[model samples]
Target: MKKIDWYFDFISPFSYLQGELLHTLPAEVEIRYKPVLFAGLLNHWDNKGPAEIAPKRTWTFEHCAWLACKHGIPMTMPPHHPFNPLPLLRLAIALGSSPEVVQRLFRWVWREGRVPTDEIYWQALLKEFDATPEMLDAPGVKQQLRANGEAAIAAGVFGVPTAVVDNRCFWGLDSTDMLIAWLRDDPFFSSEQLRQAQQLPQGVHRKT
Candidate 1:
């Protein structure tokens, strides 16, 4: 079976949207759900999230809503954007980071439109999982989360909802179709044009 490491953060609306579409991948593929902190990625890459910018933030939400409607997937923005995803990430690790747990968390945040900061909903979620905040805060759980973040950086991941297969990273919800094509042994991946594109020289760099 082909293994794909799907790195995502609960704070990313695109991640939630991607989660809903993972089932469209080839049956031979085995997905490894990796929960990473989106903020950690931004810090490491010296970048800002879309929500940190004004106009782009509005466009992002609007585009996501449009995508959901176009794809016929149920999605609703959480009460807030870019809320702390650490708790949700650790909670997923505490629950073994299984696909079921990951999908459940995504749906809770995106479909149900709730955040951990919502005390009542948070408590209900914990009760349903037969867990507690202490469990999510366990030393091992925290370490695993840290490890996931470190591994993500090491893998050259710069964003959430990235699917890494054979060390090649396909990023964003838009890349889903490309990933599916590549998984199905698309010849473009092995063509000479792709090799030439990889060898293309950089024209210029933005001033720091």
Candidate 2:
């Protein structure tokens, strides 16, 4: 069976969006869910998240809403954007929850639009999953999250909702269709070497 390594962060709306389409993958393909921190990845790459910029944040909200509505999926932006996702990530990992649990977390944050800041909220959520705070507070949970982040960086993954099949990385929610095509062994846009070779030298930057 073919394997797909799916890297995602619970705080990313794009990740939530992509989760809706994960069922489309062929039954023969095995998916491995990897929970990584979006903030950590951004920091590693020296990149800015969509919520970090005012213009991008505004556009992201509107765009996400449109997409949810278009796809007939329930979606409501959480009270806060880009809030700390460590708790959820740790909780998921510590509980050894399946990918479906991750999807539920996304809905709690995105579709139900709830902020996980309160202890009461977390307790209630945990109870629903038959987990306790002690599980989330386990000593190894934090390290596990860190290890996941580091592993993602080492795997050429720069962002969430990424799909890696045999070392080929596909980033972003918009790349789902392309990823599906790739899983079926379809021809891609171009080989990496060909793409680099076709690039034109710009201005005086070339051998001037």
Candidate 3:
């Protein structure tokens, strides 16, 4: 079976949306759910998240809400954007990071609009997992999370909701169709124009 590594974080609404659509991939494909800290990626790339910018943050949520409606996926923004996703990431790793656990965690945050800081709801989530906060804090779980982050960087992942297939990083929720097409062996992927596109030279770089 073809394997795709899905890199995501609970802090991203796009990640949650993409998780809902993973069912659309070909049946023969295997999805490996990877929960990585989005912030870690930003740090590695010396980049800023969409939510770090004021106006982009507004547009990002608005666009995601529109996309959710268009796709008929249930999505509600959490009480806050860009919250620490380490706890949730560790929890998923601690629970083995299965598709079920990852999807459930995404829904807990995006579908239900809840954060880990919400005592009552958070407690209920822990009960559902048969786990406690202490369990999530285990050193092994934390180390696994770190390893996932390292793996993501090695895979050239600069964003969440990325699907790494054959070492090609298809980043963003909007690239789902491209990913599906590529998986089905679309000829455009092998076209000369595509090859040339990859060789395009940078005209300029923005001053840091």
How would you encode candidate 2's per-residue C-alpha lDDT over 1-208 as one tens digit per residue?
8898889988888889988889998779998888898988899888999998999999988998898888887888787887888888887798664777888888888877876796677778988989877777888887888887888888899999899888878899888888888878775556776477559566665452
Candidate order by decreasing lDDT: 1, 3, 2
Q: What is the per-residue lDDT of model 3 for residues 15-124, given as tens digits with 9 covering 90 to 100?
A: 88889999999999999988899989999999999998999999999999999999999887888877877778988999999999998999999999999888899899
Query: What is the clash tally of candidate 2?
Result: 0
Question: Of the candidates numbered 1 and 2, which has the greater TM-score value?
Answer: 1
TM-score of each model, paired residue for residue = 0.97, 0.89, 0.98
> Per-model C-alpha lDDT, please?
0.93, 0.84, 0.92
Candidate topping lDDT: 1
The reply for model 1, stretches above 4 Å from the true place, is none
lDDT of 3 at 152: 92
**lDDT pick, better of 2 and 3:** 3
Q: How well is each residue in 13-116 modelled by candidate 1, as lDDT tens digits?
A: 99989888999999989999999988999999999999999999999999999999999989978998879888899999999999999999999999999999
